[model samples]
Target chain A: MSLPKVRVPYLLLFPGFAFLFTFFILPIVNLAQTSTQTPIAGGDTGEYEQTFAFSNYIQAFVDNKEQFARSFVFATFSTLLALLIAYPLAYAIAFKSGKFKNILLVLVVAPFFTSFLLRTIAWKQILGEEGFVVPGLRSLHIISQQTTLTSTSFAVVAGMTYNFLPFMTLPLYASLERIDPRTIEAAGDLYANGITAFRRVTMPLSLPGVVAGTLLTFIPAAGDYVNAAILGSPTSKMVGNVIESRYFKIVDYPTAAALSFTLMATILVLVTLYIRKVGTEELV
Target chain B: MATERSLSPEARSILNSQISRRGVLAGAGGLGAAGLLAACGGSSSSGGEDTKTVRWGNWPLYLDFDSDTKKYPTLEKFMTETGLTAKYFEDYNDNDEFFGKVQAQLKLGEDIGYDVVTPTDWMAARWIRLGYTQKFDAANVPNKVNILDSLASPSYDPKRESSLTWQGIMAGFGWNTQKNPKGIRTLDDLFAPQNKGKIVVLTEMRDTLGIILLAQGVDITKVTENQFMNAVDFMAKKISDGWIRGVKGNEYAQDLTSGDATAVIGWSGDMFILASENEGKFDFAIPESGGTISGDNLMIPSTASADGKKNGEALINYYYDPMVAAEVAAYVNYVCPVKGAQAAMEKIAPELVNSEYIFPSDKTSSRLHIFRSLTPDEETKWAEAFQKAQGN
Candidate 1:
């Protein structure tokens, strides 16, 4: 008889997987389930109920369209700005610069040594009314004294940009570093100017990094409350603060969980569609 | 699927090793901890035949415990004399956060494993209504006389039957002297042009609005719908225009003290910290119109018993004893609810005893409107206004 092919030890994954399922997936599932429960007639829980209030999602979209739109606009603008800045640095590191590349790369990664909150707060102070940038602008008369810089949406975007810039830059560098320079030389020799050579050969190759870095920065930036809470004025508060207030400040867990799920679902659908449109072939 | 019978014994054993090692190792730590807990947990405070233990939870850094000093002098004395060991747990930071934690346990009518907890006045009222707490049996507390007469007949708990306040503090405006030496008398100062981008308000929902309503000359005791909109609209305008620096809570003091903030809506005690640190850099002032009032209270959790609860209640009572209360007041630099603690504090720290921030003068006292709970609509309106104002 022929020897039987061995089956994979797939069942072996169950134990480790079960641990993750219990800890991580279970809570998310529970939050979704709790979001569906209807409120009882008499609410000594009049405060809040696990009342599967689907209206929360509607309210999140309709009632607070300004906050939602602001978050999206912020995420989009910051990611685009980051890509503009990072692509050049990534290109210089990957194709142009030599010798001190490792040292420069280390310097790029150095901010990660400090706490994320601390760095963000530092950015806030640096951009405050009396901050280095604002005062310098005032003295030069670039912006007048009464001009509000900190405690606005403008400041929140600035803070988010400062904090997540490295996330965008590092990935772009990683992607660019993997591209073979000879292909670009070949393109240059054929008929291309430096810009054309970059557009055809370099940009396509680094698209994967652009996609990955954009997603990394955009997802966290959209949900960020700390940046908005500290840097933005009251009008600049985002969906994160809404969810936080629903759960923590107000104890309205059902609606909070509902808003949370809505955010998760929307991000998933948008990111997946973005990926398909961009196409994986050019990205790699 | 494995074709185990056809497999070599070693392969099956390795499979078992891979599966069991991680599971068993992970469980191993948990089991060890569980065993260790079982062994030591009882002796720590099982409440055997002779003695009892009471557990209490409070805010971080609220109590005066000198870090360089190894012992808790107050607790040490309580344990020595009463023969009851106090198990203090610093687990609470906010009223709502702690309430959310214990509400489920309370709903199920189970003990949250704490004998006493400290919540502020409005939260105490809500908790009492929900029956999450027990009424104090005054006869059991020998030191009940130390309870302040003013605190005894408050509306939340008539006859002082259930809740008791430990300290009272003024909730008012504390401006940066760097901005104005003329003093910010009315609520109008916060909205004034020169103070724009320099104003700081607490993020707390009720306190922020209470002061605003009072400044607008509305009756804060009864919040009318029209009154709420007027207050919210004014706040909304301030927020939308880049007139406010930022809204914050406890960190308000830090912002003010560092000169990051030129003026702020601040708590008296928190402001005192800045005042004491900066000397003349800051001033905690009660606005001429009105400001909110608040007191942190100690209450018996529902599970507290006649014996275990008595020991815990005595501790609050003990802290209120004239001399003891004065020491705590001076250390905290907050309003002493114990009427005579102010007099006793005067004998020791004359500056604090006379300070209106700590012990409000009669004129300031009359204008202070202790904040009450808002109807759901008021809160949502306020939240909506706050969001709109901040440009969120």
Candidate 2:
């Protein structure tokens, strides 16, 4: 005898779906609603009324273009730097390490064991004017007495690179490990040298990982405010810092929400275009 | 019905159980939604008369702690005498940050879980203006007579109904004596060539801008937007020219102690605390032009129940006693806001009774100016301008 079909999968998803609907989707809807609100006449510190104020986006953009540009620039630099540093390290672990591979991988990810804020704060001490690095550099005459490393753009970019390095390394290591030794050997047998074999065979095969690593590093670096807040000066403020101050210190939720939406939309458009250009057919 | 008839009895029963499970799941989901709605509509008061505990939120290091007992002496004494439990929290960090955390609940007239909180003058003004605070019951606090006349009627609460002065602090220049032996005497001294990139300024807009306005020959208490922006412009130039090392809040103390900054626009209380630790290595000076004097004030939030308010008032009254206030003042090292506390301090800690930072002399008091209260528009505009000047 045949039994009637039951929709168990849909039933299993109902609880989780309801949770996301209530928490995630509802907040997004509320944020979107708040983005179009304006302060009421003579309202108290944080009071606002819905006015369909679409110009808030334009106003936020105009007011904070410098911060937006700085964020993107910092993110781009950090992504490229992370890739440069991580690719070789990941490649070594994938191909060169014999018995110490596990330990090295653990070392690569060990920074995560500490809190992100604490690690960033440690960087502050290391890069401060009174810190050993600065004093040593000054004694060597590499930097002037008046110059500092703690509150500069370089400090901010270095912080972003350091914080996001593991994100780039893990993905590259995964892709690189999947590369067959036979392919490289075949290229070598076909008269290609070591560099040519890596360029043609290994590198091209690792494009998927490259795309994933860069996206992972770049997206978070763009939205990071902590490093900038702790290690960088006001001149190095990023869009995330502006958004943070707007929300917490200024209590201007409408402008902050509008700015957040604009940032999200911009990042989405850029990422989509990037993925499309990179072509993800060979990602697996 | 046709499909069910084709199924075997066992399979049909299994299917029936599955349907029942789905029904139970839907019922649970509906129940959860209703529970959430009920929670949202629940009473917002912190506690009723049955609660013998009062929650007090304050800034870090603002209380007198007895290291030997590992407890706040005055607070422990109060609890013992009154048979009340005091849940003390040092969670009141930055004014704006704490306000942001509680503003929504406060706006809804809901408890933020604190019966008493100490906010600075400007923030207390905003709380009073928004009706977010409850008036003190004078009958509950008979020690209100000990409140110093100077702090009795602040412009924010002219009748002293909603807030009582917690502690007064001065915003002035703090210098590392080893690094800058000459020390800072004026705001212009901060801009000197040798001091470039070695000077840290406060992130508090009022303190920083007030001093700059004072240096520019403008009164901080009657500042116009034009005057304020002019002062801001001066700061903007200093920051862009690299004359200023960084803009910081409470962390400026770390910079000074670590020698990352030789001079800083810092708080008097912090400098006093730091100097005691480092001996003659550091010194604080009221800038020759003047310095900003601000105070943290205690108030009961609107969401506090009548019982909680009574308990909070009793706590305030306990602390307002001259002997208890002196103990707190001697430990905290801030300007005492209770009359007779200085005299009471001589018996408790004679060494601290003569400290200028704790009890300013008339000449020093004359050099301290209070930042004017801002209108709503001015607050927004000035904050935006200051944030812009700070390059955020």
Best by DockQ: 2
Q: For candidate 2, lDDT tens digit of each residue in B89-195?
A: 76677998999988888888777888899999999999999999999888998888887777777889998898988999888888887766776778766666666
- For candidate 2, list the clashing residue pairs, or say none: none
Query: Residue B117 deviation, candidate 1, in Å?
Result: 2.0
Q: Given candidate 2, what's the lDDT at residue A130?
A: 70
The top-ranked prediction according to TM-score is 2
Quality class of the docking in candidate 2, CAPRI style = acceptable
lDDT of 1 at A187: 97
Q: Give the range of the ten consecutive residues with the poorest summed lDDT in model 1 chain B.
A: B3-12
True-vs-predicted CA distance for residue A166, candidate 1, Å: 2.8
DockQ of 1: 0.24
Per-prediction DockQ:
0.24, 0.40
How high is each candidate's TM-score? 0.84, 0.91
lDDT of 2 by residue, A1-284 (tens): 54445767777799999999999999999999999999989887678999999999999999999999999999999999999999999999999998989999999999999999989988988888778998999999999877788778999999999999999999999999999999999999999999999899999988888999999999999889998988788789998988888887777889889988998898999899999999989775
